[model samples]
Target: MIVVISGLIFYFVIRRIRKQIDEMAEVLEDIKNGNGNRRILSETHEIVAPLAYEMNDIITSYENRLSAFRETEENNRQLMTSLSHDVRTPLTTLIGYLDAAQKGIVTGRDKDDYIETARRKAHDLKDYIDVLFDWFKLNSDEFAITMNQVEAVELTRDILIDWIPIFEDKQIDYSIDIPEQPFRVNLDSDAYLRILNNLIQNVISHSHADKIGISLSKQNDKIAILVRDNGIGIGKEDLKHIFERLYKCDKGRSEKGSGLGLSIAYQLVEKMHGSITAESEQGRGTVFQVLFPLAD
Candidate 1:
């Protein structure tokens, strides 16, 4: 009778343990199916509590990592698409010019014009490649800005002076509204120049506007620079994505840029402890505003 009682007790304990194991197996199966809702809810905390917590943590971490990877892959796809389009445009132009020259369709001044167009396309391609390389360097955390205290007004004036010839050639009128007094900021001079150059070139190439307005002002501990153009203006949809890598707007405006200019400018601004914003209406105009914190 004593032996029989012991056997019965052992059988009951084994059955209970088997049931708990089966429940855990089912929960793990659910998790393997990407259902993270189910968790081990063992009544006795001594055996499975730590295991459940660890499993949940693993699931959460995997989900987060997957999400990050998807985002990065999407960005890379967009970049590649934009790059292909940008490169193809110039290549097409170059081929067309070369074909015309070879077929004797272009001669004298027309031939010279064709050659110039091909050369310009080549230069544009080079510039686009350079911008892409810069963007990649920035993204890879390989680029560093050497910061220094500089007068903001002087910097703006010098950049404007350098671009005056291009403005004149494009038949675009520009107004500069900057104070003669010094407003200083701690920033990378070369980076700042590149930012300005990219912004101005973007306006010239993409805006196609007759008038450009630039204003620099200081308020409290910040300096604000505004670049406005009475151009075709950006669409609401496109405005939201202007800073995204290689994102372009409509076909007409799309052909104008490699789409890296604004992105690089955005990155450079952040590096300088500044922020940039854009505002536009479909037909009226577009404005880009940049704010930089003044040196303490």
Candidate 2:
């Protein structure tokens, strides 16, 4: 009788194991058929429970990555389409202006005006292309960053000195507050400068603010730089996506930008082991804060 009981128990265990194996196989087949959401669910008391949990975690991870990849692909496609349209429009106008000037369609002041318009458009085109190149280089694997320890306050002051003339020319009131104490930081100077320049450029181009303030200070072991503009503040919805590549806040097609400035700045900050954030209220103002670890 005891032999018979043992035989029955063994038989039941084998059947249970087989059933679990079949279930797992079906789940895998579903996944293979493109149902990444499929997962194995097993009771904790079962011997296969641990394996099922692990497999489920793997599937979840795979699905998340796949979703992200698909989103990125879609974004790239949109960027290409937008860039083509943006490039063609200005390019066509530029050619028309130049052609008219050459053909003597208009003379004297009219010709000069056409030439000037063409020149401005040409500069805009160059700016767009430059932004495109920067974005492409930043996204690629081979982009190099040279790190070094430098005095942060002096570096910032030197950089802003050049911008003072531009600010004055624009008639935009500006202030710079850099403490006399020198603070050192490990950073790629070129990248850091580019990051700051991009932020300032964004403000000049987009934010129609009359007042701009830049301040530098040290907190604990971090250095903080703030660029604040009292201009047309960013909308709540647009603020969330400002750092996404090719995302533009201004809705109209007439708005001229490659929409990669903030994205490139964000990436450069990361490359230099720093962080950047933007805060804004509609019609109130916008402030961008960047932080880096202070070099000992």
Candidate 3:
């Protein structure tokens, strides 16, 4: 009688184990069929509980990575579409003006004007192409950054000096306050210059602001640089995506160029161990602040 009882207990345990295996197989099959949300569950006392929890974690991680990849792929597609439109428009204009000028469609000052327009368009196209190249290079694996310790206050002041003439030419008022004190930072000078240039260029191109202010100061162990403009400010929705590649605000800003300037700036700043942010209110203007860690 005892032998028979032991046999029955062993048989029941084997049957329960078989049922759990079958259930796990079905759940795994469903997951394999693209139901990433599916998860296997088991009681804490069950032998397979740990395996089930581990599988769930693995599936969640994989799904998250896949979702991110899909998002990046979609963004690249949109960028290509934007590239097509932005390139073709200026290119077509440039060719038409050149052709008309060559065919003598207008004479004297009119011919000169056509040639001038063609020249300007050619330059504009070159600028757009340059931005495109930068965007591609930045996204590629080979982009390199050289970092060195430098007195950033003097360097920043020197950079702004070159922009003074441009501001006057654009009829934009400027107030720059860079403390004569020096602060050390590890940065790529060329990259830093480009970052500042892109921010200022964005203001000039998109912000219809007539007044601009630049200030540099040290905050704790970080250096802060601010670019403020009294321009037609960006909307709340658009401000959130200003640093995303190929993102343009059509309602509040001019839809011009490749829309990669601010994105490139953001990436460059990050590569240099810095951060960039912006704040704006409709018709109240916008301010861009960049921060970098101060080097000892």
Candidate 4:
């Protein structure tokens, strides 16, 4: 009688083990068919519990990676869509104006106005394309900069000299102060020029303020440069994302731009071991400050 009871117990245990194995196989098949949520359940006392836990961990990791990949793909798709719309709208308008001027749709002063409008559109298109190119280069790891130890104050002054006439044309008041004494820093001259240009253009294009000020000075172990404008200041929310790619505040009066200027400026400064920051208040003004570590 005792031998028969032992035999029955052995048969039941084997049967249960086989049943669990079948269930595990079914779950693996589901996972293979892309149901990553399926998990093999097992109690701690079971013989296959450790295997089940390990498989669950692997599946979780796979699910996480797949989710991340899908997110990146979606983001790329959105960026491409935005790029197409931004380019098409400006380009279509530019071509329409040019075609009108060419076909003599208007005469005398009206014709001249059409031509001028076309010209300005052409320039705007070019600027937009240039920004796009820079953004692509930066992202593609193709931007090459040759850093040099150079005199910064004089360079800043020279750069500001070219902007004086532009300020006059825009009827924007300017107060530029660059110390006469030399301040040395490690920089890429062309990159630095582009950085300053983008910041100033951001003010002229976005800021409705009539007065703009640029100043350069040394702060302890760093060189500081500031671009300030008394325009309709950016909102607190917009300010947080101003340096992100393709983010444009609907706040500019003459807000025709590629929405990449400040972002590019921020990146260029970062590549050269510098920092850029902004301070602003609604209905008050905006100030952008750039700081570079002073050369040893």
> Which candidate leads the pack in lDDT?
3
TM-scores, all candidates, are: 0.80, 0.88, 0.89, 0.77
Q: Which is better, 1 or 2, measured by lDDT?
A: 2
Q: After superposition on all CA atoms, what RMSD does each candidate show versus the true structure?
A: 4.3, 2.6, 2.4, 4.9
| Residue 207 C-alpha lDDT in model 4 | 83
Cα deviation of 186, candidate 4, in Å: 1.1
Model 3 lDDT tens row, 1-296? 99999999989878877888898889889978988888877888877788878888988898899899999899889989998999998899989988888998888899899999899889878878888888889888899999999899999999999999999988999999999899999999989998998999899989999999999999999999999999999999999999988888979688777789999999999999999999999999999999999997
Q: Where does candidate 4 stray beyond 4 Å?
A: 1-72, 250-255
After TM-score superposition, the amount by which residue 178's alpha carbon in candidate 4 deviates from its true location, in angstroms, is 0.5
Q: Give lDDT per model, in order.
A: 0.85, 0.90, 0.91, 0.88
Count backbone overlaps in model 1: 0
Clashes of 2: 0
Query: Model 2 reaches what TM-score against the true structure?
Result: 0.88
lDDT per residue for candidate 1 within 186-296, as digits (tens), equals: 999988888888888888888879999999998678999999999889989889999987777864474766778999999999989899999998778889999999998
Ranking by TM-score: 3, 2, 1, 4
Output the number of the TM-score-best candidate. Answer: 3
Worst 10 residues of 1 by lDDT: 40-49
